[model samples]
Target: MPGEDMAGGAADTGPEEWADARLRGGADAQAAQDPPETVRHTGPPAPGMVINARYELVAPVGHGGMGEVWKAYDTKLRRFVALKGLLDRNAMTGASQAEAMARARREAQAIAKIEHPNVVTVHDQVETDSQVWIVMKLLDARSLAEVLRSEETLTVPRAARIGLQILQGLRAVHAADVVHRDVKPHNVVVGEDGQAILVDFGIATFDGALAVTQAGAVIGTPEYLAPELFDSSAHGPRTATPASDLWALGVTLYEMTEGRTPFPGPNAWEVQVTIDTSPVPPFQYAGPLAPVIEGLLTRDPRQRLNAPEAEAMLQRLLDPRAAIAPTPSAPPPEPDPVPVRRRAPRGRRAGALALGAVLLAGAGWFALPLPGDDPDEKDGKRAGSGGSGTRERWKDTHPLLKIGVKDDQPGLSKFDPKTRTYAGYDIDLAYEIAERMGYARDEVDFTTVATDYRSTALKVKLVDLVIASYSITEERKTAPPTGYSVDFAGPYFEASRGFLVREKSSRYDIEDTSDLQTLQVEVCTARDSTYEKWLPEAGFKLVESPPNTYQDCLDKLLDRSSDIYAVATDDVILAGYVKENPGKVRQLENVGGAEGYGVGMRPKSPLLKSEVCASLKDIMSGQVWEDLYRKNLSPLTDRKNPPGLPDLTECEVQSAGP
Candidate 1:
């Protein structure tokens, strides 16, 4: 009947292709048939028919995946509300009907628990004549899907505003520990007042609650599912999180701007595979909101922008001043053209006397002048006529960019010996900077640097740059007993201190700093890292022998007999380790002191420092930085706090420098 023509004839095709098709219609779509039903009702209710006694169905207004809606009058309340019940319940037989009815009731229950303007409100639910009925606040609105159909695309600002509201609703839903498993444009309604409201909780579920759908069944629209839901081999069975809803929201936003979804294929399987394995297609019209869309669509649910993070990004887009970096009005320009020049020898170090003078000057130290510091230096050459004053740009002098990085950090940085390749956030970032600095991918080399040796690597010219998770501190900028006296550029990333504990260990429940103090947990962190100073000051006990790297701490945590109750480090770092050893390790929700990661270089190379800092600033303002972050870090953690562009004021070229 659902696929019938108005003339009471069987149509050639089912309503499955209709834009408003309520039932799942993808390739794998399936619904269990209901058991034979007992006589429940004589016929469908007409206008003014009071089947529930207290309410009368005035007219059918719409239908959803599992139910039909009607404009109804509440006789007792003396007001009108929207009422819902299983779609053609009497006509449906067997398990399919039962599941639909159950889902309808579940929707009622889920909406009733959340009270937010952006979320639909449930007023009453009742059972009459063996059918479940839900009463809800009537809203004068149209589904976003319908709006998009008429208006092929919306401006970036409008899409961001709508996305912000949806994200707000999601926040409230997640606060109640619920996951709106089916988040799509059809599930979002835009009201006459221009306020967007999230609706239809038919497939929503409480966190940790047994799923209402059949096991291993792929639910929701195929195009909107996060990678984890469909990619069985890579991510395993579906484990929906609030992050999943964000992914759907990302797709919805993409559609609002691009006039279509990111992944398009002839069949559902192909689309699913694309979503699981491929990067989001490049945006042609996303404009300033591209980063927000990219952040939301990250395949790694953990690395994906959470509700709060997404909301902040949207809010910033609406108010540009608050944005991490003012988004470019157009796509960023191509990489700075590389200059054709003779290559300098590898491990070429600047004069030691120049670096020593800057470092030995103590806390207020500054770069020293070189022969090329004359004011007349211009057109890529020195001011004076003599060859002695011929200035060399840092890129020309260092044709090969030698970067020191952590080989053990899982998501932040790691080396795969089998493939003889380095991969992770640090690795990707180094490559990005190198490209901007006019170096080819092959011209860049990565050297593994231990936590204690990051500065030494730079000081001794073992590496031209240290892109390891090197935190910037005043002590590190000063010379001698108190510090490494290393100069830094562009705090490219901001990391927060948090703890990682064995998932199955029952010795302690560390949720926050208060728990750490109460449980007297002995935490292990990488030696000479920020955590070493923060933990001891926060009253956390450190293991007698601290590990040389976060990986070592994770190893100690995995050993059942070790006294190390937890491993503490930047949440970004811990997230990777947790992902690398899933189920065996988990990060505590507690986030402590924050630190900004910077690129470490020798104190004398002010020219190179300025170049790297400028390159980082440019990258942060574009989509590539967001892409790199999503690729390397998003798959590791779901913590709501997302790092923004670091303040580049520290990157100002010192007047004392050549």
Candidate 2:
């Protein structure tokens, strides 16, 4: 076989050359495939060395702008692995190889620190033949870019949920003070298990450290570059901040919903300039995502909304009563057809009939069916003719004080055998409130409620309190189930329903309605507050699934079946993906508005409300709430925990937007 056989026109070479061209960017270059230089490699298996104490010399996986990644297997581990070789191989002069090797080691160490469900794992790193070899978890999936090229855009809700997961991955890395300077679609991985994992921390930088990039040596793919990354002055004299990552995330969402970047140009330089100077337009998307996108893509990084604010915004968008603007679209033209129409009947007649008994009953009205009550259960639960006897039962033990939790949310399990206790955030919180009311934890009965049936259980008095990360809304507050009123506690943790996609996605530039026809968007559900109201108004033909959580949508995006996913902004599920695969999934921007998680009690239970609120006040004012907040949210919130807005901490702040 020719040396350049698989190198792509990489050598003006053929099919194999196609692979090489993909790696090197051209035919005759010898340097790695970095921009401005295209390099191709002659086939060769290095002559000396032991890998996993077996599997002798083999050829390179392929060469690229950065370096060459080899495909190999470990005889001992009995699995395939990818080994990455730095840009310069045996040709390094002096101690450069050693320095590169050190860098490789540092990268491995940094990767090791990240443990999440969506991150790719690093297995080993070694110095061989004057070159550095970094072995990483192998994946059978195609590059996110290739997948997008084939599948294009994904649904909106799916994109939003996936976006949230990506933020999670970034949160882990950011918590370690590392910045993934290069975030875009190509770096994300959609695993066989259908989760988007962030991969390739090759260009990541530690916060506050001198940039490894030389002057005029811009890093990262062009499309997802934050305006600040391109021109620090563009974002008020800052080079890049955590907010920059969010700006890039906004671009990613744009690409997913519009099927193209919000800013596009013929060349990288032009694209970078556009990114730095241009502004994203206001356009509605298939749900209530416009506001969410606006916050994510804000050019002024400082003015842009933070993750918590974004998360809260999304929760509100998830509300069912949040009205969506109607989709503005031209009516379909009348079809050309053959005319064989039928005429209407010319006449009709009717005769009045007399009743045999000639008896009339009084006219009466029937009430409309209430939301959660089944007809069968309603009749049986009706108050007895002896009203006084029934009233006492409802008033004393306070049947309304009983709180119920739904099983749909994660970490809400009833009990764990290993722990031998009722474990989960909700379980603990609910029991704490009950204890404050002077009731034993056991007094708060546990009954598994499916997410679909949760509301029904509430209407029937099956449970008194619901602490299942539920948000209190005006609609639910106004007309509650008979005798029940809705009361809330501290917003606690904030969250949102936003978009998730590959970091460098073309959708990054999508900030308006100017480009909606080219993308494929997936949504979690049609009833999702954001998408239901916004997508139609923005003029999108939405493809939605039955009601599902953010994670469900994430799984779809990772499978490459959906381009975008929607979920709580606070979810930051991307952390799991990054942990599972390493640096792939990411948030484009928050697609919705601020919403809070609160303790829901029947409005009728003033005693419960006052008692629970007092406990909350103490917690919020003291170390207990801080400890809990730190425990569950330190990864992302510790650094920027919002200060003293006791009133706004978990409460909704209404704002007007286009």
TM-score versus the correct structure, for each prediction: 0.50, 0.43
Worst 10 residues of 1 by lDDT: 1-10
Tens digit of per-residue lDDT, candidate 2, span 49-114: 244343222345455454566655444444446666643454445666566666656655676677
In Å, residue 526's CA in model 1 sits off its true spot by 16
> How accurate locally, in lDDT, is each candidate?
0.67, 0.48
C-alpha RMSD between model 2 and the true structure: 21.8
Q: In terms of TM-score, which candidate is strongest?
A: 1
